[model samples]
Target chain A: MELKVYVDRLSQPSRAIVIFCKVNKIDFEEVGIELLKGQHLTPEFKEINPMGKVPAIVVDGKFKLFESHAILIFLASAFPGVADHWYPADLYRRAEIHSILDWHHSNLRHGSSFTYFPFPHELCSDETNVFQLNASSAGFIQNTLLAPLFGRSLNPQAAAEAEKVLSSSLSKIEALWLKESGQFLLGSSQPSIADLCLVCEIMQLEFADETDRNRILGPHKKIQQWIEDTKSATKPHFDEVHQTLFAAKVKLQMQRK
Target chain B: MELKVYVDRLSQPSRAIVIFCKVNKIDFEEVGIELLKGQHLTPEFKEINPMGKVPAIVVDGKFKLFESHAILIFLASAFPGVADHWYPADLYRRAEIHSILDWHHSNLRHGSSFTYFPFPHELCSDETNVFQLNASSAGFIQNTLLAPLFGRSLNPQAAAEAEKVLSSSLSKIEALWLKESGQFLLGSSQPSIADLCLVCEIMQLEFADETDRNRILGPHKKIQQWIEDTKSATKPHFDEVHQTLFAAKVKLQMQRK
Candidate 1:
């Protein structure tokens, strides 16, 4: 079987993978899943990934994997002769790349992920569900995370306090984008996994109708460059369907605007 | 020159590496970065890793890498046959291992780490600092992760919610442990990278105070069994320092009781 990637181009990692395949001429089939429409929730996709998440794939009926970074390495190694900067192979350099990738996976990936498309408020359909869903994560971060950091033992009301603080952390991320002076993050060099993580996240922001590029990532010259790079580099990977989705999203003036 | 590992036995990843090296009989020098005393923050350690994190190593005076999973792989591959469970040769199987490890690194690692230490609150010294240190992570899980699973859009909640569910997620993890049904997590037949991840994270709970245990893992039978297995299998790799760390923690608890 040829490599089959079930993805929605609107998703950043999905877009990056689609583009990486095209740029390197890696043979593959693009299967679009309207993520919001619950396409990935099908029994078929669940068989592929128990998590029922996207950016999943099967390779030559052999190696199958999820998690974007894992996929990135697997594909890069399999494809061969793609841009070396996408993932360099020297042991030391590769380790450096992995370190940066790990940091990006958690920070940039989670940073933009939480800000643009918050999960709890949407997942919980009712007040009880909302309280449980939101309260669970909120409780953990504040009671378990923030309380320890502040040297205060866990408290029942701590999550509310944390919610206040979490609301303001976005600008720190924008500041990071500004601090790095490259056109693409991790330097003026070509976009690495770091760039991919960030682009995907900020794309969520743009989709949300909150296009304050400067407020989020505008201060960072390199992040802005990455947006430009991704836009130009990955056009063909997007089919008419995916393009329509983005157009529909940008049409509305969403919150965080 | 032998490898040099900067570590403090209290940290899970550092202890795991120490165990791995000792069990394999790999030669190495130990440089303790007393985390409580902020030795890791000193200028000398910063030169080794800008993040000033523990569990970094310098090999042959050249390759310097961070990230526990990356380090485990590098060591296993570097010293072939030292251990089979660290990573397997089967690409597909290895991919499964990677999925688990990656998730552990991003989620379980944070949940357990924060519950144990709550670094952001303690270290940041104030509300602004706490937000500056860690709110983004809480928010990301809330908005990006939790919402997606339920077929909803993300809100600024997954981070905290994800953390809260962690206390309960232990049961889910126990189900996984039960599902595996073996001495090691994957099987009694052999260990896998899954074991490495579980062993490290679970070790923290095993050594955690009974009060903390009830607060989190709660001596749940499945969790207890897995902990027992890890201890028996990992004893060969256990350092005297860790033995004392465990003993001291338990002893301190006894005094309080």
Candidate 2:
């Protein structure tokens, strides 16, 4: 039996895993957990991942793994001969990649919070539905959803605060981290899993209001170009996996119309 | 010539490196960076590490590496024969370690924020002196120093807030991650680098007020025992490297008296 990859395409990490598996041609079954529908909360999914988070995998029907970084490393190591570049063999280079991934959790990953908090109402059909959705879920409601933002209304100050955080995050990436890497981080010719993790994160900004997205990402040219370069390098796999996000955006636009 | 580890023992991650190197008997020269004196701000140190953080290593006096997680992994891979359990050979186990390290940055590691923000006054001798220290520095001041905390006064609300964050963090570790581990995470008889990282982080909470420390750590009996076990496992090396923090705490207590 092939490995089972449980993911919700709308989740950034999920998209990265799908892209990785597809680009590397790793044999796996893709199981979708729709976050919007609370499918991840189902007991069956809970049995697979007690954390109720996507981007989890069960390998060979035995070992269960969560955390996108771990999952990426597992896939890379398990299929080393095939997917060598996603994770490198060189000790120092691989360390740099590891450092980037670790640093990412607090830094660039803040983009997720900034993206959702600014425009939560727009993410769902209506405010009532958003609250009802949260009410139905047991335990904690997942972040980056509409419910958390309902406690605080959207205002200029909130937008500015989010922009400040998002911009600072992007600036650190541009100034501090990517100076060595011309096109990709750590100077890799091909995109690494770090690149996938970051691009997917920045892509979340697209789900934000257009004004906020441009304000936050507009000043950082290097980051914008790096995102494009990562996409171009990855090509069809990148586009294919991200279609869900694109579809959601189009649907939101139609709803507004 | 040996690998050079630049560190300030007061820093949690820096202490982890010192303990790791000493325990493993890795041939490395310990280069001290006096964070309290603004040594990290010097242009010379900046050339070595622009980020101005300690726990950086220069291998063979050439390739410079930063980020304690990266440095730990680099040491593990470079000297694999010496310390096997620190980072395991088993792919799944290593992946779990990676996940913990990555999860740490946002979860348990937020202890840094809670620790410093709660006790701003006792950290320095005087407010004027703290400003002078910051003004003299050419670069950013190191964390766990008196400067950043000096600006904010201690309050019950701050302590409560820190406790809330800290408690929520500890609960997740107890309920979710450590289900499989016997004494150490991942069920190893010996503690891994994940143990070093986490224990070092929790140790920082000790610097908080006794009341705050009890409130923060009191509920989690397993975590407290794990800390003791990790200390026992690491032993004299752990005590030796932590001397600086211990002294600082003593000084703070004396001042309060």
> Which regions of candidate 1 are displaced past 4 Å?
A60-64, A80-84, A118-194, A207-211, A226-245, A251-257, B117-164, B167-188, B207-225, B239-241, B251-257
Candidate 2's residue-wise lDDT over A1-257, tens digit each? 36899987777888888888888888889998876676666799778776566778998888888888888988988875555678998887898888787666754564334433223322321111111222111101123233344463334443444455557778877877678756888767778889988888778666655765676678889899999998888788898888988887777555445
Which pairs of residues collide in model 2? B181-B187
Predicted model with the maximum lDDT: 2
Q: Model 2, B1-257: lDDT tens per residue? A: 36999887767888888899888888889999876666776798877776566767888777887788888988888885556789998888898898788767654654334433223222321111111222111111123233344563334443344455567778877776656658887677888999998888778665666775686678888888888888899888988888888887888666545
Task: Report fnat for all candidates as fractions from 0 to 1.
Answer: 0.36, 0.71
Error of 1 at B179 (Å): 3.9
Give one digit per residue, the lDDT tens place, for model 1 in B56-127.
888997667776677777777677657666677655566666666665655565555432332333332110
- Report, for every candidate in turn, its global Cα lDDT versus the true structure: 0.56, 0.68
Off by over 4 Å in 2: A117-151, A155-158, A180-182, A253-257, B111-113, B117-158
Task: List, for all models, the DockQ compared with the true complex.
Answer: 0.30, 0.38
Q: How well docked is model 2, in DockQ terms?
A: 0.38
